[model samples]
Target: MDIEAEKARKFRISDFDLIRLLGTGARSSIWEGRDTSTGKSFAIKRTFKQPEDDNRYLDQAINEYEIASRLQHPTIRKVFSLKRVRRVFSIREIHTVMELCLGKTLEEAPPNSLLEKCVVLIEVAKAVHEMNSKGYVHADMKPDNIVVSEKGRVKIIDLGLSCPLGTVKQRIQGTPSYMAPEQLVCWPLDARTDVYNFGATMYWALTGELPPTVVPHQDNSISAHQKSAIPPHIVKPGIPLHLSYLVTDCIKIEPSGRLGGMDAVATRILVIIRELERDQEPTFRIRQRHGTGHGGSFLVSEYRSVAVSERLGPERHVIR
Candidate 1:
């Protein structure tokens, strides 16, 4: 949209046929571009003017290039090339060409679409696990940074904020709501920081509400030392008990108490999937639906039965 900034730029959209604007951010704009020679579609992230306030922007760009080029996973967006273009005004711009992702962010995804959300989360967890195993961490993990493809494939994007383990204490970066407490305090981070963020992301997926910015502590509370944290189930009753426990564990005030790493999180999710499958009966299947397009239609029936006591039999069945 800033025509003056782009005028006479070596990486003009005309060089490669422009499709449409994808999105714009503080320092860059993303566009869908087709390579003139190969006719291949790629997402081009172009930064016109570097932020004068933050010297880290250039470092982030270089880190992104380095990180993306080394990663090869189905759930991580692939980088095709990195180009440095200079304009007539003697200003240089950096363009990163990456795989074009087609779906909306998790923030924009509709509520009650539980299945799709779980699938996406699982894919992202796998990707994060891969990164953690390689001794890296996606310091900025949030809904908007994740891309869900048309076919429901999840890809983690925007590695500009990512860094190797124990290298993020220089600045407090990442979305505040989804940021771990250590990140907020500008402490040296590791895989545990990402685990905390992943928990926050899951909390959002399970409940439409976002978690509080800071946790509150109660003197007599069981987790009094943990601070302002509340269980996810307390906010959204529909969340399964196991899942609520898993999420809370990931967000524990002490990083050591959280899941060991992304691999542990992925394993737990896989275990949940298996348990759900094993519990399925020929008469009915219980699964959560995710995203929009259902039009409030109930894909399956809702049935609830009460038990008065451990010795009592299942009580009256209520169907909704």
Candidate 2:
């Protein structure tokens, strides 16, 4: 590292070097740092002092470490080490060290990058599937928790709300918009919950708009439960119908109705990639430009979607 970079790396707060502030939440702040002894870059998540809130945040940190430690997927951030420190002022602090993932969150992704978004989502889905197969649920799955690296790889982070399938019902956790309907009602959850959240995440990526908070009972208005049926072309015209349908199926309200699982989602995405590879020509029609008075025509190829699977399989159930 250069002298400036070295100086940047040396800045500290309460003995730990603050390489960079990764993100902040209601209870903690995450920072990028390096272990001086080993010279390895790691992500350090620090929780603030609030005795009453300490146990909650501490439990979350431990859960994150436990879940991540058991997972060895390319799309999941890896935890290297964890530690706790108590200051002379009587404040307890907890820190978790994870492999440094240099990238931006999907929330910060550019709107015009549809193909990029599709590719990233598929990778994340694969990772979530692997986690699910192991009986773990990433209770908090959202754009903010998905990291996009400079090399274009996606890694899911912040497993604070995650828990093994059977234990999640004891805690009502996860973000509002990304939370499944069952989660909102405090019902026991499973891998399908993550599938629903991932589907919503993809919807946000395709439309550049968040899923509607008010779920309409009828087809006249958009409902989160009906998200899997909304075509990308309906929001922004000209996207391939096949792609639009793919996204629609992923967001189905009934977990059983959604694409079979993450592996199924990945398989469908791969089919699209194969078709694109076979024919480099653009297959979908592009919308025409109205006039100078109106905005230029947006590229329809910029968005994608998924279709629902017709076949049925053994339902994966959680004991909770």
Candidate 3:
């Protein structure tokens, strides 16, 4: 037997308990698993093919491992290990183990107040900024790809289709709803592509709607030129106008028109966060000390109706 075949034969299935199927992607099927040795939970990914099938997804699975190995960020999911050699009915397969973020995705989770959403959004923007800094674009970013931990930790997961910032793939690869105009045209991609996706993601989160984009797979009539996305401000008048503008800037049809890069987006959003924090610092602090909740439990003084306002944040949940 070859080295891989020998290794596969030696590895035992008892080492890990595959709990259940998590989800299926273009390259692999993800399973919720627990290591028998450490009793630790993980999301296990493997080629989604029967034993007799050829090695089509195996290479993509390996590529995902290579590309993901470089990432190390607080908000990005960690790939703990890779099992490149596995056996199922004498057929060699591949497996990748990733940290299992504890909480549900943004959509599945209970409704988060706008402030909570803003807090989540900034962290995701920071993660995207880091990826861009390292010369990679998280070519695939949607709400489902983002999971919040029980303790409120945000994690960006799934790197199956991520590519180098400027790479021109053989074909388009991205969720149709989130793809930027450049992706539709197969143009050289960069951080701005992620900006557009992030903007569209924000639009959906705020209005419970998917923003318009150039999706060639669906139809040619709604190309970026033929249609314009309805700005979030109009869709939901309650969202702060400034916040809506921030998202709109990211989804500009022209890359040059985007808000510079993800780093800049992060910085701009940080400013907004600081402003919100400052705005609430005065009377709200006294209320917390005097025993009052965030609702209408005002202190019955000059600032009686001083309730904490609902705020907005960011996140991406995959839809397909």
Candidate 4:
């Protein structure tokens, strides 16, 4: 008898009461589970072996647990444990327990304003920086992987593609629209890779559009020839020019051209937010009686625009 198999046989799916199906992936499903012994709730991810996948899905499931469990950050969801089930001599299924994050993904409900989005991305940048400092790269980062709560808390989820810093993958892996150019080929991935993905994510969050990447989106016909992304302000008028420039810099094709690291990215965004808020205030509304009748006149004061282009200075890298 295999020692590991004997140990795993003691734990089974019946140990937890699966309350509801949270979500599903290619060959996996996430469930809201309650531990029968302790009555504690958790998010349980289960992946099953399949003939066509050839253990790819199982590898990812194990990778996700290994990488995520090592990371410790408030904005990053916590992964608790990994369980394997064997049928005789071979493992058949894997389950990972994680913090049951309650919120809608950024894809389902994005922040309503550029300010809100910037704030959310700032938290995300910090979380990724934490991952980098811990010697890991979050290879997959997109709107769908970030969950934002009603009270404005941000939590980064999904680490299946994550790897040790400077790891050269055996094959291309990442979401197409948000993938960095280096990710298209089997290149040595580092913090810069995450920078590109974060920038692409930010570009989409601010402009409601995807940035140009190596793997072109079905709707992005010009992506192949496009050298750089259009400034966010160009795609969306109200986005501050400074904010737009920062996002574009992040998605630069070459790793050296993008923001140096996640820390720099987070600090720069924080500065941008501070400048925007300090220089401008929310639009104010006023009402006055026009003809002294039931019908009254009301007018909303135009939103004041911040001169961020000038305030940001000639050198974009300077945070101050």
Index of the highest-TM-score prediction: 4
lDDT of 3 by residue, 1-320 (tens): 23343334333344788776655555456667889989988887766455566665675666667777898887888887777564555436677888876556765552334545665677788888888889898877888788766544678876776788897766777788888887876778899989998888788887888877565545433244656777777998877777888988998887888997887777666666556656554333111112221222312221211222223223331111
- On lDDT, the candidate that comes out on top is 4
Estimate, for each residue in 1-320, the C-alpha lDDT of model 2 and write its tens digit: 23344345443544345566765667677677867766666778776556565477777887889889998987799997777776786547677778777656778654233544565676677788888889888877889888755544568888888887745465557777777655655566777778778877777777766654434344333344444435676987866677778777766666666776677776676666545534543333223212211123222222223332322122211001
Give the clashing pairs for model 1.
113-289, 113-290, 113-291, 114-289, 114-290, 215-228, 216-228
| Global lDDT of each candidate | 0.69, 0.65, 0.68, 0.75
- Candidate 1 matches the true fold with a TM-score of 0.78
- A best-first ranking of the candidates according to their lDDT comes to 4, 1, 3, 2
Using Cα atoms with residue i matched to residue i, what is each candidate's TM-score against the true structure? 0.78, 0.74, 0.75, 0.80
Could you give the candidate ranking by TM-score, starting with the highest? 4, 1, 3, 2
Off by over 4 Å in 2: 1-16, 52-54, 86-91, 214-229, 279-320
Write one digit per residue (lDDT tens) for candidate 1, span 190-274. Answer: 9999999999889887876666664433431123264555788898877678878888888876678889888778767655644
State model 3's lDDT. Answer: 0.68
lDDT of 2 at 11: 33
Task: Quantify how close model 4 is to the true structure by its C-alpha RMSD in Å.
Answer: 10.9
TM-score, candidate 3, is 0.75
Model 2: per-residue Cα lDDT at residue 129:
82
